[model samples]
Structure formats: C-alpha cells, structure tokens
Target: MNDDRATSTRSETPEAILHGGDLHAVSGRYPDAPQPWIDLSTGINAVPYPVPEIPPSAWQRLPAKSEERILLTAAAARYRVASRDTIVAAPGTQALLQSLPRLRPRSTVAVLAPTYEEHALCWRRCGHQVHLVDDADALAHADIAVVVNPNNPTGRLLPRDVLVRLAAAQRRRDGLLIVDEAFVDLYPANASLAADLPPATIVLRSFGKVYGLAGVRLGFAISSADIATRLRGELGPWAVSGPALAVGTAALADDAWLAQTGARLARDGQRIEALLENAGCAVIGITPLFRLIASPIAAGIADRLACHGIHVRRFPAQPTWLRFGLPSHEGDWERLAQALGSSS
Candidate 1:
C-alpha cells in the first residue's frame, strides 16, 4: 500500500485496542459467569518463576544505578548479548514501544500484522504513516519496520537470517528495524535476534511473558550502543523500579527454572492443541506459551467459554480465530476441556 493512502486511512487519534489479561472487563461483560475466571488470553507463562525475597531497601529507597546495572548484566547474559551497555531496561516493553517512534522523524512504518495491534497504534500515535503488511519482503519498503518474532497469536517465527537481511537493508538506507521478541524466550537461543544484532536494529524483550511477572513490568531493549543510549535518555533515570530490578536480576539468572518451565510449557502446549483439535478447532500455530486455533464458530465458542468463566482471546479482524494461553492447573485444563466440548 502507498504511504499517502495508508496515512490518510489512519485516524488522527488512534483508538486503544483490546488486550488480554483484563479480567475485570471480561467479568463486567459476563456478570453471571462463574466466580474466579480462568484467563487463558495472554501468552504469558502459566507457571511463574518463584519471586525471590526483595531487600527491604528495594521498597524503602529509590532504585540505585548499581541495582539497575546488575539487572542489565543478568539480562545481557540471559539474552546472549555480549555487552550490557547495548541493553536498556524499561518499566515494560510497552513503554519502550511507545517511546521508539518518537526517536525518529515521521516516516513510513510497516508492521507485520494480524499480530499485536500495539505496534501500529503506537507508531501512528507518534505521527508515523503506518501500514500493516503480511509479507516480510514488504518491510524493506518502509523507513521503519516492526516484526514480532514468534509473533503473537499466530506464533509465526521469521528465520534469523531473513531478519538479518531486512535489518541490513534498513541500515543501508539509514532506516531502522524493530524486532519484538516478547514470545521468543521459549524458542532455541539461536532464534533470537538479540545476539549478533545488526546495525540500526532494536530488539525488544519482555521479562513478563517468560517469567509470568507482568505485574512487576520489566522489559529490555537490545540495540547498538548509540541507540541504547538514545533509548535510555528517552526513558530517563530509574525508568525501572527497585523491586523490579531485584526480581528481574534474580529471575534472569535462574537457568534451572527456565529449563524446567520450558519443558512443562512445551508439554502443556501440545496438550492444549490436542484438546482444541478434538473439539473440532484446527490448531494453526504452536508456541510453548499458547496455541492459535480456527473454527467457524470462534466468536460463539468464546462467548460460550466466557459464560463458563473461561476467557480465551478472540480477534475481531478474524472472527474464525481464537488464541488460547496455557491453563495453569489441572482444574483449569479440565474446565477448559468441558467448556470446549459443550461449545462444539
């Protein structure tokens, strides 16, 4: 699509899009639904890492520079990035996403779509001409290109080499490439773009998804030193809280917990897919944290699940599709199965 046409189509003020994990909103819609809704909407890990005890000072005092450095160091090691200086911590990846567009002049932005809507919304809010494109090749045509690796909902994973080539193209034109690796934690280390980052490329990682600590709101941006410095300046000092620093530092270093959780999530992922298939929904995507399925009655099924106090994600743009995050416990699994059987 042409930039002028795309720019004209976007509203001057973008509307906020619906996101998962808002139990209150769902409850309000389905007031008669059972108590304690099972929220299988976001791709966050069902089993969260055990939070380590925080020092009293973490709450008592403002975050110290040294504490932030420690967290960054741990994140750097975990992401396999060589230098901590190339990383910048934020309150969450959402914060970084909002700020990134302001870093550059208003220009053409291409987002790989039917994925997270926030990327397009954020860029458009910053006065960029944003277009949604399904083709990775179309990304080269934009001044800034945004891709979600192991993409949300669809679980689409672009090869590292393909992204590298796109990044290189953007670099040659003094453009930028933004890769959101929010769901890549469960994939092999080599699947990430954080390691061996290309020039003019920024990688956004969400600590919340893998660790299941979305409330703590910790995330990072991996980029060239200059870009990292620029992002740091934009976020200002102590952008991350003291408790978040403490929790993130401890959690990122726990290699054993990561391995164990990855295995469990993998098994649960398969189980959910099987359940959906048996319920007559075609499973289309497989990421360790969630599954995407298609059924002609997807909206009806979502409403049925909501009535049963089980909330799964449904897309307005694609009424045939639904996304299911892993259920945390046996009861949740059983509840979901029964709901699906009835919905079918």
Candidate 2:
C-alpha cells in the first residue's frame, strides 16, 4: 500500500463528501452501463434481515408509546446496554448525528481523522470548531471527540480499552466521547463499548448496516439517562415510524438469525479479500461489511467496474484507494470477478 497516497487531511467540502448507494447519480455518470446495476459501493450488508410482517395498525395509526418502549427494550438487550432508559431510538443514526451537535453549546470538536466524514461535517455545520486529528491523544484537547470503530472505508477497529481511556479523559473535563459502533455488530464482544459505557460517553449503534435493512431507518444512542432524555426531547413524538419500531423490535430479538448472518458475512469477507488480492489489489482494511484496497490505478479500476455496471466506492482524497462491499448473490460475485479481471 502506498501510505503517501493514502494519507490525506480532512479538507473536503461538504458538497465534495460522497457516500455510497447513490445509484441514480452513478447511473447518470455511466448512462450506457447495464440495467440493474450491481451496487457494491456502500458498507451496508448486501443481504438484509428478513423483515417481519407489519400489523395493519402500524400503518394506520401513530406509533404508541408502548411500541417505542418495546423496541428500545429489544435494542437495549441486543446491544447489551444495561438500561433501556439509557438508549434513545431514532429514525436513524444520521438523525442522532445531526441532533447531537445542537444539544451542546458551540465548542471544540476533535474527530479521529480519515474515518467517517459526517461526524466532522455535522459538528462544523453546527458552528463548532472542528479539528480533524490523527490520533486519540490529540482528541483529548477538544471539548468533544468522535470515533468510528471498525471505521468506514478503512475498517480500522479501535480496542475497547483505548476508547475507555479516551472517554475517561473527556470525562475529566466534562467533555463527551461519541463512539460510532455502526459496523461493530459483527464482533460486538470484541469491540463494542455498549455493555460497559464510560462516563460522558455516547455510543451510536446503526441497525441498518448489520441488519441489512437501511430502509427501515432504525438506530439507537446509548448514554447516560440524562443525555438520553435530552436526545428524546429533541426528537419529539413518533421520531421513528411504526413499521420501523416493529421491524427493529423483532430483528433485535432474533439471536439465531443474527448469528447465522454474522457467520455468513465472515465467510464472504474472506472470499472477497482473496478475490481482490488475486486481481493484484492490496487489501488494507477488512471488516464483515466491506474491504478497502489500494492500487495505483484505483480510479481507472472504479471507472472500468462502473462501465460493467459494478459500482465500488472511490475516494477523492485517497486516489489510490477503493472500497468494495460484498456481492449479495452468486451472479454478482461472477460479475465482479469478471470486471476486476478486465479492469486489471
């Protein structure tokens, strides 16, 4: 891997920050590509959780307080959060991300660099002085610190102990530590800080990524009761839809399905890594959801794949890097392999 080409400071404008799953935009760019494009752009699970049937009432009426409670209870258990009261359910983690900055006064925010772009973007947009720092030790100087474990696009997983110490440092100054555990579901016991949360820390868990149900729009924030309550107040009544509540509740309780999916994703991760390596790409990041690779012709490779109707993630800042999510079906695997062979 070319470290010089891969290392870039967080200097992208909000408009320049691109995310995956934008088929419409990609289609516009590659108008003559194939029909039914194979989207391996986002880190989202290619195979989503089987959604349960929604009751008629869930569609007809507003979500009841009882329903919300039940969803939170299930999420609390699924995330190993000690108290339901400490978890605040929302439409999605994106909503919580936007709302979090508003809850506090404008202050210095330090984000572990080259992780998710949204954390720094949100804080900066909310009038905070945002610094994109290179290490956890640098984060200690800021009023709020954000860390994305098993980080997006790179698959960097910070150990629980490292995060605990960072949180402790933030606590000493009454600062907050926000840990985004969006991809930690695959190895929760090894990486998640949800079970034993540190003081002045807030952990955001994404239901859509691991569950493969991004459309359901269910996510939770685990923190102190006071912080949770404040977030709940910010998100008014029925912040999450009725169908989302039902689906989240049912999915979180299905431990068997979760285990099976995790195992499958693990196998798929290895399969993709091997495939990339054979294509002469150096795999740098490995998570159950996606793989990041480095190649001198990464941009050309992405375009070639796009022409074949296979969309992988390309970073503007890191031109040598490309990130690919797992192919959902056997046909997708074949298509990707063919595309990679042709691109090389």
Candidate 3:
C-alpha cells in the first residue's frame, strides 16, 4: 500500500492530517470499534506530568514581562543552560520554526532527510532552496544545516562532537546551524547540545513533548545573544499566554516530577519494545518516549489498529516503518496487544 503522509494546520479538512493524531477523522471511519481511541501516533508522553493549579490572576490578566521572565528562568535552570541572554521563549517550537525562515533572506538550506518534514516544509514554503541530505555528515555543503537530533521516526541521534564541529565549520562560512532537540531531553545529559551552544547555532527545545503538555503551547529557541534578541523582537511581545507562562514555570521547576516521570517513561519504553518484538514487529529505533518498528504490512497493520480504535503513525518514506507512542493504561495496552495479534 502507498504510505505517503502529510501534515496540516489543524486539519481543517477531513483528509488533511495524514501525518499523525487525527482521531477526529479516525472516529468517523471506525464508529463501531470502541468509545475512546488509543492514539499512539506521536512521541508525546502518555502519562503526562501532573499539571499544577494556576492562579486565577493568571487567567484574569495579560502575561506580564515578569511572568515570562519566571518561565524562561525556570527553563534555563531545568535545561542547564548557562546564558539566559541566548534563550528566547515562544508560544511553541512550531511558531519559532515557521518564523525562522522569515528572519533570514531566501537561501539554500540543507535538511537532514526523513526527519521532521515540517523543517523542510516551512523553509520551502518561505521560498528557500531546500536540499535533503542523508545524514548529519552530509551538512558540509549546505549554507544552513538543519539537524533533528534524536531524529523523529528513526530516532537517529547525531553525536555532540560532530554537531559542534559542523556548527564551527558552518559559522566560518557565514552560514548557520539549526538543531531540533524536541525529543532530546529524555537523554538530556548525553544528548542535549544546549550547554555548550556554539555561535551561529540555533537549537529548538519543546516544553510540551516531555512534560506531556502539548496544549500548553510553550517552547524555546536557543542561539547567540544577538540572534536571540532578533527572534525576541520578531516574535513580538506577549507571544505566550499568561496561563501558559504560569503552567510552564511550575512544570519546569518540578524536579521531583521530572525525575519520577523520566524514570517512568524509560521503563515504559522498554516494555513497549519487548511487546512489539514479541508480536513479530521488528523494533528498530527505540527512543525514550516512542518506538519505531518495521513490519512488511505496516500500512495494513496501522489500518487494522485503526479498526480497533487505535491509531499509529505510518511513514511512506520507509514503507515498512511504523511509529508508536507509550500506551497510558492497562486497558489501552491490552487493546493494543489484541490489535497487534490480529494485524495483517
């Protein structure tokens, strides 16, 4: 079966969201399978961090500069970033991603292929020349190099030293390096490039993925102080809501929650790998929050899962591959196992 997929801006049409998490459309197709759908399409933590109570004033007033400061400060501390001047907060990583093309003039951009398609999509839509490279080592020739560390779908993480060298080389030629570390925090100490950020390097981190608060709509862009200043101005003031700022601050500062949740995700990821393998699916790339598997009948398997009111991500680029997120509960896990057992 043809497995090509696409993403949308909220899936205005029923057929728009081909990428993942389109339960609204799934429900229409499988009305008889189940009541609630078990969506394992994205790498978001299934057991999300417990959201703390927000002050009523947070909802009553506009997000002040002081409130933003608290959120950024908390993010810096949590991420172990040394310089606050180099970090710029936004409504979400997606907002910064699309705006990045606007900040620079049309130029040649080399995106590591088969990662997150949105990187290339946003650049191409903004009139930039985009070239798809095979790996991080292929960044040598591009004017702007985009690396999705712990890459989406494949979970192929580029080495820190290699990234540092690439950034230095790119900067020498007046070029730039953009790293999407959206899924890097699960292995933060070993995987993150935030601590020793090089000049001309722009790193994007997500508050929603690890914290399981995608709706909170908060993220950060890390770069040189000048670039951060420029992005801050371009994004304008009050880019994030007061409720988002308050909630993000509490979530970022919860050390106990972070540690406990991280451990739980790691443990759960292993269970998923074993389960998938036992079901005859080859567990290929295992990330802390998700797993990418290979099945001869991946498209059919995904369709079968949908019939059971379970949704998984399928990639046409690699016809045999499917991505699955952690199932949140015992019933959901049992449902998934039964679905897999019955998969074509």
Model 2, position 90: C-alpha lDDT score? 94
Q: TM-score-based ranking, best first? A: 1, 2, 3
Q: Backbone clashes in each candidate structure, one number apiece?
A: 0, 0, 0
Best by TM-score: 1
Whole-model lDDT per candidate: 0.90, 0.89, 0.84
Best by lDDT: 1
Error of 3 at 141 (Å): 0.8
TM-scores for all candidates: the values are 0.96, 0.95, 0.93
Q: What lDDT tens digits, residue by residue, belong to model 1 across residues 1-344?
A: 45665466467535878888888988899999987899999888878989999999999989999999999999999999999999999999999999998899878899998789999998887678888999999999999999999899898999999999999999999999999999999788889989889888999999999899999998999999988999999999989999999999999999999999998987888788788888889999878888899899999999999999998888888889989999999888888989988321
Q: Mind giving the per-residue lDDT tens digits that candidate 3 earns over 1-344?
A: 01121222213223222577777877788788776889999888888878788899989988899888888889889888887777899999989988898888767789997788888878766667777899677786888899999899788988889998999989898999999999988686867888778878999999899989898998999988889998999899889998899889998899998889888888888778777887889988878889999989888888888889898888866889999999998889888888888321
lDDT of 2 at 53: 90
Instruction: Compose the digit string of candidate 2's lDDT tens values, residues 82-146.
Output: 78999999999999999999899877889998988888888776677788888888998999999
